[model samples]
Target: MKKVFQLILIIFSILNSAQQSEIFKLKNYRISVLNDSIQETSGLNFFSEKLYTFNDSGNPAELYEIDKKTGKILKILKVKAENKDWEALTNDGENFYIGDFGNNAGIRQDLKIFKIPFKNNQLQNDSLKIISFYYPEQQDFTPKNISTDFDLESMIYLNGKLHIFTKEWASKSTTHYTLDPDNFEKQAAQKIETFKTGFMISDAYYFEKKLFVVGYTKKTEVFLMIFNESNSGIFFKNNPWKLYLGSALSIGQIEGIAVDETGIYISGEKFYSPIGNTKPYFYFIPKEKLKF
Candidate 1:
């Protein structure tokens, strides 16, 4: 097909950060396990076309409209907010951003990001619209352990800008920030330049312009970055990240990724806890079998 898409983009330009495997024949995705061990699962979003999961903490703030390809939950939306460790999610068709900022002990001072609006696809209430902010530069543990703890799970809202991704505790590597949820608080985050990515970056999705980032350490990998449209507009800020590492073999904590031309959907949230109770796997990657 174009030489398997230029050899998976030349193995994502020699990008490898652990788990070890560079085969690339990709198109092997199937985790079809709907609702199991999902208590403190994490964030995932798509809103309405189905697939809307959330959790990491508390209350009746649930929503899972799944079935992008048979992970089947069908419908279950209702929120009030208490999803503390919510982590990351993205949407802009109207609402559904939800990312309470997972600050794994970097000492959070109140970092949040919740929108939740949507109407026809239902979900027009429950009082939600909090886009708090933090990280005014105060870091430590230069490379201590637990994977470079910057926290933020994953996010996306391109064009209007809202790209946040970082989960680098002991340094598995990932850092990209740029937010302005319409001036969340008079514009705060603006760094967007760090993806030496070798591993560790738990969730993120941005279809057409393609930017899928999943993660794992003992195995479970997925990375596809392609946001190069010359990055059009007002003194462009940071659309320079380019990395591709996917062909799946280490499928242990793939987290969650979503793209829809009827292809590309992954999830692996078995984070060790009383989650939906244990059994989450829904991988069906295909978009010309993605390369590298």
Candidate 2:
């Protein structure tokens, strides 16, 4: 019996090591309703101190810009076709890249991200770039059965490359992968690392040497994982993912996160169906308040 107990303890230790994540708590900020009509928001981004989001409720996905710290909608931009299925959003310091690749069932044969260039809030023609790619290892569109497996929900740009993180709803764990920007082919991403998040990872952002990933469980929450590395780059592998904040029980779905030298920003997507529509949210945690 003693030998058996020791073996079980060893096994549990190894499993725990593989599943550890950040130590900080997640915090969610509330939003005031701007419109009861703009519903089922799917994608979001931060540009020029403003929050930009898109909806996938019906034909012609619409774009809305709002104040960075307030949920107030400032402007509603042009629409771009129907069923774009906007999933994730990122920027390259100059233009915004909107990813329309939401393969929840894994059956999608074609996936793409649109790069829309913006100058002083005005759209530019022929400046639109679409990036297309797919998963190399996946042969079928079956839901993942494992704890740490999930589909794509969010991503960010690090060192000129697009790093995508998956949100495995069934497993509550997150996986990390990277896409090369210079490689126009937009090949299947290479696996970088995995954080046994133990929570749904909705979006990620890299700022001031720290990485912030947000999601929730019993309630809407955010996980702030900080990376400590040398100038060589790959050294980030050694950084520990710790819990950042735990917000109010009322905080809804946190779908997007973006960071700058000033502070960190997050956006909440409205839940649809019988419950009706909830207002979109733009909340921020200052740079000084974010613990490294």
Candidate 3:
């Protein structure tokens, strides 16, 4: 019996180590500190071959086109919708989806996503659409502050649907849900899959059958997870390649990620804590630099 128990402990140790292995550090990949106008940069996406980002809650409802090389704001486009804690940004080929569902307290009833039309290198704000949704599993309306698992921040567009990943602060996991882009009426998100990410997922980007998610732990440790799509087009069915990016103390609060044929782009909002403060920054990782 003693020998059997010892073997079980050894196996558990090995599994735990594999789950949290530190693969890469992103400190060396930072490109430049972003401008002050978008200090609270929350989400990133590409439209018409241009990189775009916007500030989060309490900021203006505008999107900024940024230079991929220098992190400078090239132009700003106004939106007709409300910012309302916008935390995730994604796009189909013709439209941009902005998720305004950052439910930190987990008591918000107005979770919504704004679908804005983009054409001819301009935003057709007159045709903006709002997608309101709720989690059917959420029974309690009590405010749990930062201890709720229903808060969401990461999202992507795939297979003609909007895929949302919850931040899951209390559970240290993320739940995947899908919403219809054309459904403007109040609807319930369809739960798909959940993964034990061990961190709060802030943003996700999908490219070439691979999904990249970025977030930070409460201890200020930031990480990146890469998962390959399964045969049935599901993520999180297999173990992801989890890489430790860096501490938030040094990297700021990483809140956005976008990928293109060239490589990956990440953005961090200005972060302030009792220990230190980090300015908003932008990072670029070339495709060749990644080993897997």
Candidate 4:
């Protein structure tokens, strides 16, 4: 019986290895190393056909417009909102939404999204609005540190609603939730769906009916998942094409992704570990280089 159990375990290990081997590797896409000003670029978004990014918490409340071919800051837009733990950015053509909801300890009760109107190449910071929300299912305010599953960093604006993806550290999954951008009062985020990504999601982007989500695992393995939008507008119902994007040690901590008709743009923040450190990087992958 012992030999039989050992044989079964060997078979399972082989099958798992084979499955992991099928994941495609992304390579030859490094464009340039990011500037030191935006070393903590946590989110990426395209507004009015221009690429923009911003740092996470502990940085100024500002957005940096960067050149696509070269990772250089072209302009900086100062915001009037508090940074807090701003982790995600999205736009609705007329306004940009900044998500200040990075709850790594899962004890935050003041999750907010800042809405600022952009008109005629100007940001109307005077008319900024704050939208507050909370997870209705979460009854506890305990501090779980990095083990909490309520941390969020990925968001996208779609069809008049803001879609948020949670960074589930303990479960290695992500939960999709939707919130009304027009609502100003504190409300509950409507739970939609959940997907087992096997990694914590950092940032997300939407383009041409496709959703691009990027993140790194605890083992420092970076990955990107491309999901096709369903006819009913629900994502994660279909299996995504998961691609291995290399190790964080070599590529830095990937935290931002932005896709367009031209190509896909990925940004990684400076990462440090006991072993070594990596500088922030920017990468561009042409649409033709991707399988789907």
- Could you tell which candidate, 3 or 4, scores higher by lDDT? 4
Query: What's each prediction's clash count?
Result: 30, 18, 0, 0
Candidate 3 stretches greater than 4 Å from native: 1-19
TM-score of each: 0.33, 0.74, 0.92, 0.92
The window of 10 residues in a row where model 3 has the poorest summed lDDT is 10-19
**Residue lDDT tens for model 1, 1-292:** 7756755553454355322443442234665655663534465677646676665655356767776767767777776777667767788888777777777666666777877787887776674677777665655534333544577788888788788878875666777777778555634667756655556677877766556666654333455444443353121234434433443333334566777776667676553321112345667766666542
**lDDT score of model 2?**
0.60
Between prediction 2 and prediction 3, the one with superior TM-score is 3
Candidate 2 Cα outliers beyond 4 Å, as residue runs: 1-31, 37-39, 56-59, 79-83, 143-150, 182-186, 218-236, 239-241, 244-249, 272-280
Q: What clash count does candidate 1 reach?
A: 30
CA lDDT of every candidate: 0.62, 0.60, 0.88, 0.89
Candidate 3: C-alpha lDDT:
0.88
The residue-by-residue lDDT of candidate 4 on 162-201, one tens digit each, is: 9999999999999999999999999999999999998899
lDDT rank order: 4, 3, 1, 2
Can you tell me which runs of candidate 4 are displaced by over 4 Å? 1-27
TM-score winner between candidates 2 and 4: 4
In TM-score terms, candidate 3 sits at 0.92
Q: For model 4, what is the C-alpha lDDT against the true structure? A: 0.89
Per-residue alpha-carbon lDDT of model 2 for 62-143, expressed as tens digits?
A: 5778666665667877744344467677777676767676666656666666666788886553666666777676676665
